[model samples]
Target: MSESVAPVSRRGFLAGATALGAPAPAVPAVAQPRAGIVILIDRNDPHVMGHAISYSGNLSRYFTGKGQAVPPIEVVANGLGIDVFRADKSPLKEPLATLRQMIPTVVFSMCASSKSIAESRENLTIQLIDGARLVPFGIGRMVELQRKGWAYVHG
Candidate 1:
């Protein structure tokens, strides 16, 4: 007995070869434990600022609650939100301090542009609370953090 074998067409063979030679789809990198978080706060309302602070604290708790280490968190304040960082003007001075102590990795950032404008308009020097740093621009800082694979939160 003789057995007959079917021949593959040139088109079918080329298609199969192309499919096999195609590169696999790229995958997104998983977030590492070292990844950070950036929070944007641009409102002037005291309630809003309070909420932002609370939100950050809650995030820290979330990590700890899961028995995981908390990542670095940055709260960037701009526009009217800069007022929340003013040492003498902020109603949250004590709370801010407590929050910082509770979460050492949490940082509060003030926008230099907003500070300059606020000082010029209000005719009062702006003072930052302890642990708060100044960034050239709030939005820019957030963008940089995001590029570095940091999570983002707006409050």
Candidate 2:
């Protein structure tokens, strides 16, 4: 007589493995980062800002779909990128607002140096959209965030 074994169902296999102390699956750090991420935008293009927003939103969706908490995300703008956050001139106001609504923890920051230069060149006070903050130096902020273990993405 030949020996025979019954097929195991997925659930049964999992249960058997668990009983044997098998480790549970782990999600990647990027999917549910503990230290969060920083998105850098250094251009004066609306397209780049839109793309950064989309990328941030996608990151949010990725982790949330898996029932994971979104890590803190900061979109840091420098140089001509400062214009993207202008309250009066930006064409991406709606998209930026939408991204904020989706990820309340997401932050928008502009470089003070850039803003000052733009103001001097244009001879007008540049007001950032509500909730957008100004950092002393964009590069410094990036480095600080990195020092704290936050992931950086150039958008």
Candidate 3:
């Protein structure tokens, strides 16, 4: 004798689970309309820069794919994170330049204070990537963006 197995539908399973007091699965939050987004990177590691770049690219793609306009994105690098913007020391120069070209609305900002400090401490001249802008202060820039209703992400 073969044992018969009952087929379970998705609706049945969910209803049964709910009836058993099992919590419902969470749904992802919908994207909110915003002026723009700013990403803050304060680490000196190349990995941090890579993550920032990847996240920025993904956000841009997500909005465009969803038929929504992509918002302006800015990556503000300060503290040790400023190293990722240095042409001579950074392994990300080429990739940064390419990303700048590929994403028109994405911009990279390097902190002037951090560059000065690094130059004095490390005794090395720092050259930023072609499209990177020199901001007076990375933290200040982030604050400014936040005040303007831009979403902030720490990477």
Candidate 4:
């Protein structure tokens, strides 16, 4: 009598192996930089700044989840974005408050020329932190930051 042997397929073998509770293969961990991202906000509208701020905050959280460190982010406002700096004219109360909670995590920068215009031409009382560095131009500052190896993100 000839003995019959069942043909074993690769899938069957794998199934049997899995049934034996074989450990899963280890995956190589990917290395990511712990550097922060620089977000440049140069909107001329309060609503736009609010949206930009929200975008920055969301991006920061996303980078943190991907095992990457987000570098210091600065939201430089000039032209019309300075409206958010004003107490009365500011329309982004909620967004600004959320940004304030991030505090030192995110930096705020305003254009020197815009502030000058606000004071001299508009006569508006705008408040900004001392940490907010004033630059001669906002777009130029963004380019400078990019040239300095800082990742430039615009909202």
Candidate 5:
């Protein structure tokens, strides 16, 4: 009886070699924690945006000092606050631009109802980031955030 040698498939050998030669996929070393925070801004009030920005700055500095990660902060702006989010014509343009640069992690939630009012009454272009999550009402959003385990500080 003659012993026969098994034939190895070229494709299978090449695939195994390629897989072994490749380096392990690189992973990000920093870990991000899930922190939820809600900040309510009274847009109808003339002083709200200034206060909110100041509060945000303080909160960010506090978190940095503590050596702990800050939660995602959402600033819900309605009524007059929406003015900050308005297209080029906003009076708070310079302030908003500055705030945006400083707090890149903050989410600015503009009220859709206010946008509708702007469209009908003033023909204002409410420039918002695409597909932002809408709360039933700006106040409702504040309540919702509080109920959903988010820390709330009204400024």
Candidate 6:
């Protein structure tokens, strides 16, 4: 008995060749420790301020899950962004305060220069929200954080 050889179509040959030549699917490298993140906020809008605070809290929740170390999350506010940090002027006082207490790792920072400018303009002392720290300059502080391997995010 003679065995018949099947004829291969051009399309079938090319498809097989392509499949054989395809590279293996890429996979993520070994699990890496969560890195720190810096969130920059420069607008004076209440919505923007609230969004930044909420985003920081979300990041904190994600990084701190599974008993992982609480990576640093710095919310740096500059220019008019200082308005949100103003204790008396900010509308998000309640929510921001709650976030501060719930996630201490998510720190809020306002620019001293911006505070001075706002104070000069308003002719009054700008009291920052409780626990809000002041940086010498927002951009400068961001640069320092970036140099230290903290990822930068704009809010």
The lowest-lDDT stretch of 10 consecutive residues in candidate 1 is 24-33
- lDDT for 147 in candidate 3 is 83
Query: lDDT tens string, model 5, 35-139?
Result: 477777665554776777677777878888999776677888777666655564455556656666777777777777767877789765556643234555787
Local distance difference test values of all predictions, in order: 0.87, 0.90, 0.87, 0.69, 0.69, 0.84
lDDT of 3 by residue, 1-155 (tens): 99998999877888888899998666579675567989998998878889888888889889989999889999999999997788877778777777777797688899999999999998987888777889999999999889888999988
What C-alpha lDDT, on a 0 to 100 scale, does residue 141 get in candidate 3? 93
Candidate maximizing lDDT: 2
Which model is ahead, 1 or 6, in terms of lDDT?
Answer: 1
Residue 132 of model 3 has an lDDT of 83
Residues 1-155 of candidate 1 have per-residue lDDT tens digits of 99998899866766777799965455579766467888888988888899888988999899999998888889999888988898878878888888998998788999999999999998988889888899999889989889888988888
Superposition TM-score, candidate 1 onto the true structure: 0.77
TM-score of each: 0.77, 0.77, 0.75, 0.64, 0.64, 0.73
Which ten-residue region of model 2 has the weakest summed lDDT?
24-33
Please identify model 5 stretches exceeding 4 Å from their true place.
1-35, 129-136
Q: Candidate 5: minimum summed lDDT over ten consecutive residues — where? A: 125-134
Off by over 4 Å in 4: 1-36, 129-133
Clash pairs, model 3 backbone: none
For model 2 the local lDDT of residue 87 reads: 95
Number of clashing pairs per prediction, in order: 0, 0, 0, 4, 1, 0
RMSD of each candidate? 9.4, 12.1, 11.8, 13.8, 12.7, 11.7
Better of 2 and 3 by TM-score: 2
lDDT per residue, candidate 4, 88-112, as tens digits? 5667766667676864577777788
Model 1 RMSD in angstroms: 9.4
The better candidate by TM-score, 4 or 5, is 5
Model 2, runs deviating above 4 Å: 1-34
**Deviation in Å, model 1, residue 64 alpha carbon:** 0.6
